[model samples]
Target: PSVKSVIQGFLPGLALKIFLIMLPKLIMAMSKMEGYTSFSSLERRSASKYYLFVLVNVFLGSIVTGTAFQQLEQLINQPSSE
Candidate 1:
């Protein structure tokens, strides 16, 4: 396998792992910056932010990417004479 292909395969998973590890801390920091003085409030805001991130990134992103790939495939496979 070529180095480019290997890096392409590995980099996304590695980046995703790093992002997942950092996301909670990042959200917590942002929440603190937003000035939630109580622990419960901070946790609540952080959890909501995390949930929104997951919903949009994972669910909506999957749907959008899947549809885009399907369209690209169809376009590529379609005959020019049509």
Candidate 2:
């Protein structure tokens, strides 16, 4: 109940989640305009952008009353038996 109550308090996170999902595609579109000389370079740029997105979303997000770390904690707490 306590966790559920905390999760239910924030609503805008849904929109942020949606934007993050689409971020990679957005990076690809911009990469096309940049005209990279090699396919690997384009892929690398897109990957860098995606990682930056996650880094900001995880590290900076924790500064707020967000669930990023909570989910991380849940993942870390799982048994290694799996």
In lDDT terms, which candidate is top? 1
Q: Which candidate should be chosen as best, given TM-score against the real structure?
A: 1
lDDT of 2 at 40: 86
> Compared with the true structure, what per-residue lDDT tens digits does model 2 show for residues 2-81?
87776776556776788888988899888888997687898899999889978886667676646667777888998457
Q: Each prediction's TM-score against the native?
A: 0.85, 0.53
> What's the lDDT for residue 59 in model 1?
85
Off by over 4 Å in 1: 79-82
- Candidate 1 lDDT: 0.91
Error of 2 at 64 (Å): 7.3
What tens-digit string does per-residue lDDT give for candidate 1 at 1-82? 9999989999988997799788988999999999898999998999899989989997899899999999999889994784
Clashing pairs in 1: none
